[model samples]
Target: MLVSRCKFTGISAPFSVGAFVKHLAVPLSTRLHCALVNAEGGPQSRAVHCPKFQALKSHQKEQLHLYVDALLEWNQRMNLTAVREVGEVMERHVEDSLSIVPPIRDSYLSRCGASCGKISVVDVGSGAGLPGLVLAIAEPDWQVTLVESMRKRCVFLEHAVNLAGVSNVEVVNGRVEDIGNDSCFREHFDVAVARAVAEMRVLAEYCLPLVRVGGLFVAAKGHNPEDEVKNAETAIRSMGASLLQVCPVESHGPYGQRTAIICLKGHPTPRKYPRSPGTPAKEPL
Candidate 1:
């Protein structure tokens, strides 16, 4: 009875994305294969029954295998993620991030009567490049800009992007608030994504300003999103946006329950949005 529930919304279907993994010996090029071999008791393994891994094409599974190896290797030296187990990485890190893709494609690509075009996407607070780098790998035509305030994480992201051979991604080392206001990036994206970034109300302030009018902001959230969504109503409205849908994702394994809180940028966000550096978090909306 694994169910992706969109409570308080009139939806019966589970949230899913376009068909988009594998286990292997320590992958090449990182020079730490041996270390990963012994660390965490062994290489992170995958379950064939996992929904996300099964949907991936064989080639994609291979690429994910390599990416996981790199993540495990780098995580030992620097703090990347709290989920250190191989199986956990497969579910929580890889699959949890991939869940946002379905809504992204459905909302952004098909926004104009079924016509598709190159899309500019910004991944706010892209620590360790979870869904951002993942999205870049999954969608070649979509240009992805990963924004992170910490230099160390950005360094890791650069390395991962290069090793993954994804040419469409750029790692921008800066705060989202600053980047959101910059003329070069502000209101220029077709879509924006944030995961575990901040509370819903504060998150709206951080991400909505980056999307162009008629664009989307997809927030990868956890199980209890109703209250957050209720609280963020004012911020969403004031920021010239509206809730498109709350898509509950079926994370059948260790990934647990997830939600994609989709917001439509109906009009331009007020120029003063996103407030100062830490204002949104300290005092929401």
Candidate 2:
């Protein structure tokens, strides 16, 4: 048996390995209640029978369930995501985002070197909060900002965050270009992460400008990204970022190719970055 704490107040419930012992925590919010989860695995485990459920904390497991429920409920009226089936949502959207947790944590460790606290993160073009909302549920200690240009998506994101009982998340309804220059957000985050937002070059511009010097931009993309990386050379360099590594998404179950492109920011992004709203996609650096 092992113990995992609730994100809201750090209240824990114990459960035996390989079986979920249903329990609830001190609930400040409805979603803060606990549920099924297995508490067995190393930091990088490909060992569990269920892939998505492999490494979740107790609260995170329940959080995922609630998040999926809300997504399914809202998706009917709003078309929030193309992934419609429950199983597909688990594998493609939810677990795929969770797969990046290792590298994101490694990046934090690289920056803080054994220190523990919230690392500021931004999810650029977070349509329906694929990785942003999922990351927040899995890593509750990390402060996550969901940046979506579309108003409806922002409203959905805000609801999802509230529904998940996540206090460490904020939703920003604006484009990267506008927000990147605002003093409140410019080059202020420890990490900028995006998935299925845009091509690598365009993503770098939208993401890098929001990352502080020494921060990282982790872009989740489909496999075979050589051309994307090659095309992004100029944009990456101009944004004061360098390719760190491309890690395979191995923990998210057997699926099509998926990779996390990690970029380390070496210096401040040039002031002209993320040029007016659609310029990054139109002009591309």
Candidate 3:
């Protein structure tokens, strides 16, 4: 039997794993409350409000649930996320991923005239498919590519995609640095995004090369990332991108606030960029 304890309310309850899985389909309020269970059997985390998850359609919700189920099951075999409980996954990962949808969509629409055509997006360092898989699930018309270097994570991504039955996602098993230089991937996407991948400077090199001149590169960052944004200014300029805006997003937890740093690709990236595999992190611009 598994026991769940609420950190804020100090409430405890015991239930089987099977029962917990079944409770995933319960109403948002109940599920959100139940998600506070801590993985260490201690008090659960505080409840999070996910307006984005609340906005999902029934079928979309079903797909997300399936993906979360696979994530929790696979996590037991390998390290995926620190938050193991289902509700926490929904709050921290699913809803956190969903938070970027509006910014990406609105940014594209505001710049591209709202034609609503198919947009190509690439997710760099997509460990466990945070925004990549979640984005594909939310926007069916968009083509999303999940780039993960680890073969094991790639396998898990494929399995989760298959289980969710989402056909718009493609899992690639390779380093982002190499992919950035590949003709097939370089400058081929409408937008590129990364979350918890690296610092802003190093992350800019990995993602900007994959975006076309008129495209966007969004980095999911923690709250109070002004210093990081300032430090990465040189790197951002070197990558042919200009700092567009730093948009505030929903808080992930006690982390205060989260933000999305949006950069506009104005010119083609220099061939020298992404500098050899493992080079970017070793010596950033």
Give the alpha carbon lDDT tens digit for every residue of 41-84 in model 1.
43343434457666877766656666776787777666778877
Better model by TM-score: candidate 2 vs candidate 3: 3
Question: For every candidate structure, what is the RMSD over all alpha carbons to the true structure, in angstroms?
Answer: 11.8, 11.1, 11.5
lDDT of each: 0.71, 0.70, 0.75
Query: Per-residue alpha-carbon lDDT of model 3 for 62-147, expressed as tens digits?
Result: 78877776777766676778877666777677878888888888787876455436999999988899889999999999999998
Off by over 4 Å in 1: 1-43, 47-49, 109-117, 276-285
State each candidate's clash count: 4, 0, 1
Q: TM-score for all predictions?
A: 0.80, 0.78, 0.79
Candidate 3 segments whose C-alpha is farther than 4 A from its true place: 1-49, 113-117, 251-254, 276-285
Name the TM-score of candidate 2.
Answer: 0.78
Over the stretch 142-224, how does candidate 2's per-residue lDDT look in tens digits?
88888876655565666667777888888776667777777678889989998877888888888898998888899987778
Query: How many steric clashes does model 1 contain?
Result: 4
